[model samples]
Structure formats: C-alpha cells, structure tokens
Target chain A: MVKLTLNVVMAERNISSQELAKAIGITPANLSILKTGKAKAIRFSTLSKICHVLECQPGDILKYVDE
Target chain B: MSKWLKIGINVLIMFLRFGIVAGYFMLIYPIIYLADAFQNHTTHAILNGSDFLRFSNNQQATLGAVKRFPSWPYALIMSVGVVLTVWATIKLLKALIKLLSNIRDQNYFSTSNELALITIIKAQVMMLLGDLLFASGNQLSQSWLLRVNTGVFSETWETCFHDVFQIIMLAAIYETYRHAMRVKAENDLTV
Candidate 1:
C-alpha cells in the first residue's frame, strides 16, 4: 500500500495546513484531504509545490507500507 | 437518456399533478355523501348494481342486506382508499422528479439515487395497502359507486401484485446503486 507521509513532513517543517494550502495554491480542504491520505492522486505539479515549500524529496513525503 | 424521452417523463409527471388535483376533488364527494347520510338518516342512492359490479352467487343474496346497512362505513373506506392513492401518487411523482434531477446532474451513483428507489417502493406499498382497503370496501358495498370510484377489486388486487413486482425491480436498482456508490468511493480514494 502506498502510505502518505506528507503529514509527518509538514510537522517536521512546522507548516500549518492553512500556510501549506496558501503556499501550494490549494484550498485548506484539499490540503487536509492530502494530509489525511484521502486524496486519490497527487498531480506532479502539486507534489512539486509541496516539495518546494517543505524542501523535502518526494520520497520523504511518501512510503510503501507492506500489508 | 434522450431529450424527448426526458421531456416525455416530465410531461407524464405534470399530468400526475393534474391527477392529484382530481383526486383531491374526488376525495370530497364521499365525505359529503357521508354527511348527507348521517344528517338525513337515509343515504342518497349512491350506487345500486349487483350484476355489473359482479356479485358472486353467495353475495347476490347479500344485496338486500347491504342496502339495509348504514352507508357511512363504506363511505369512510372509500375516503381512505382515495387518500392512500393520492399519497402514493404524490410520493411517486416526488421520486421521479428527484431521479430526473439526479440524472441531470450526472449523479448516477449516490444515496439520493437509492432514496428515489426507496420512495418508489414506499409508493407501491401504499398503493398495495390502498388496494386492500378498496377490496375490503368492495366486499362490503359491492356498489356501482365503488366500481366507478375504484375499479374492480380483483383487478386492483392484480395491480397490487404488479406493484409488488415493480418494488422488486426498484430493489434491484437500489442494490445496483449501492454497488456503484462503493465503486465510486473506491475510485475517489485510489492513488
């Protein structure tokens, strides 16, 4: 299963949901959807925005969890 | 799914609104009859026919007895039948309208779709119960008024069976909607 670690990265970066949403040009609702792993897919552009804002590699925000 | 087909359904629903008005008007007559019967202590000859109303060999002898009996109960039953039918028609039209709007919004899979099917089931159930009451009233009165008001008992009973069949069909559609909603949820959650 693909587990999102975006919440963890956000925590490490000390970025609030509202701040992240503003930085990524997304609504807080959508940012919450991603942080909670409810998003179906993340566009590369969105991922790039998050990476640029947090200064983290894509792998730092995603992980494969074997179940 | 065609434009004309959608419009046709809408027109049918519009006619049903007219029917509801007719039903409301029809509903008043029985109450008036009941009032007249109670006030005068003798009802107007609302209906008198055993032959055309199809009295059984057993019930043929009961015609004299039916006339001697008070007519208020039959009137009350008739009113109940009309009320149930009108209620069912209203529910059915509401469901159809909701379904049309859902289709218009491309909401093929959702709880609202299932709700429409459920409304149809409820309408059918109400009609079936109304048919039962009408059948019972028919047994008591066997009047031409009943025949004119609510058609044949056996026919409406058969129609109740058809409504049951329709309920089954709607249940199948409801199940399909449930499955479609699940698939939609899965798709929305997939990465």
Candidate 2:
C-alpha cells in the first residue's frame, strides 16, 4: 500500500502549509491536503514542486507502508 | 442564491447549450441532404424538359423552406451558453485558488479546510483538462494533417486521461467529505 507521511516531516521541519504552497506555486489548501494524506494522487510535477520547496525527497514525503 | 444553486444553474445552462448544438446539427443535416438531392433532381429534369414554372416553384419552395431566422435563435442561445459556462468556470477556479491561497497564507494547520481546498483544486484541474481534451478532439477531424489512426489514438488517450483524472478527483472529494464530517462532529462536541 502507498502511504504518505508528510505531516511528520512538516512538523519536524516546522514548515507552515502556506510557505510550502507559496514555494511550490500551489495554494495552501492543496498543501494542507497533501500534508494530511487526503490527496488521491500527486502530479509528478507537483510532487517535484513540493519537494523542491520543502527541501525534501519523494521518499521523505511518501512511503510504502503495508496496508 | 446559495453556491449550490449557482452550480445547478450553471449545469442547466450547459445542458441547454448541448441541446442547442444537437438541435442545430439535426436541423442542418436533412437540409444539406435535401439540397444535394434537389440539385441532382433539377439537373436531371432540365435535361428532359425545360418547364420553367415548375422549376421556379421548386426553387422558390426550397429557398422559402430554408428557415433563415431560426439560426438566429440557435446562435443567441449558443452564445449565451458559452458565456455562462465560461463565467461559471472562471468564478469557480478563482474561488478555489483564493481559498487555497488563504488557507496556506493563514498558516492554518488544521486538516479539514486544507483537504477541502485540495479536493476543489483537483476538481478544477480535472474539469479544465476534460474541456481541453474535448475541444481538441472536436477539432481533430478538421485538420488535414491528422490521420484516422492518430485521431482515434488521441480520442482514446483523452478518454483515458479524463477517466483517470475523474477517479483521482472523486477520491480526493471523498477524503475531503470525510474530513469535513469529522471536523463537524468535533465542532458539535465542543459546542
């Protein structure tokens, strides 16, 4: 199963959703959704954008946890 | 009016536009076929006998039966539909963008609004992409460079993309609704 753990990273880095949104050229609402793992799928471009802004990797934000 | 009411109106407007387009095509198709048939019949009749009165009457009837003014109503309806759809789409997109921006800027760490905003954005993107694909497919047959295979492939790709996008959008929407329900429950408890 695909699992995302962005919340933990955000907490660890003390990154606000707004900052992440601005940096990634997306709205904070989108960032918030991503943070909560409520998003069904992530655009590769958007994922790249987020990673670029958050100074993280895809693996850092997402993980494959057993369902 | 409420936001949901506005959305309903927008949907009705879209349906009206679709009906108008269908009606236009239905009206024009038989006329085109009849025109071709009449032209062929006239050519054959002229070869046999030059009955000027009958020929003139036929021409007059065809011209009179063409229904010129009906096009105006269709044009007007189509124009209005296009404007309404465009306006609604823009308004929704702007609202989504603004809400997302606000949520991010305000640094609201709560999950509910964030999830809703994300779902909204995904929905907008899917809608935009679907519209684009539809418009592109509509034009594909008109292009000289486009082959039947290419057109078919493009259409298939468009369908696949639209389906996948919709599925993702629906999933996001479900997640948002779940979060909203949870948030509402928490708020009720607090109150």
TM-scores for every candidate against the unseen true structure? 0.64, 0.28
lDDT tens readout by residue for model 1, B1-191: 78887787677767767766765666675566467567743223434433234334344434556457556776677567767876887788778777877776567776887888888888988988877767666655445333332443333456667877877887887788788888788766533
Candidate 2 Cα errors over 4 Å, as ranges: B1-191
- What digit string (tens of lDDT, one per residue) describes model 2 on residues A14-40? 987777778778777766666666666
Q: How would the docking of model 2 be graded?
A: incorrect
DockQ of 2: 0.03
For every model in order, what is the iRMS? 3.5, 11.8
The residue pairs found clashing in candidate 1 are none
Residue A17's lDDT in candidate 1: 88
lDDT of each residue in B1-191, candidate 2, tens digit only: 45665566566556656655554444443343245344544223222332212322233323333322233332333233334334434544544444444444553444545554565555555444544443443333213212222321123346546656766775777676667767765543320
The runs of at least 3 residues in candidate 1 whose Cα sits more than 4 Å from the true structure, single-residue gaps closed, are A7-32, A39-67, B1-6, B32-52, B55-64, B68-70, B142-156
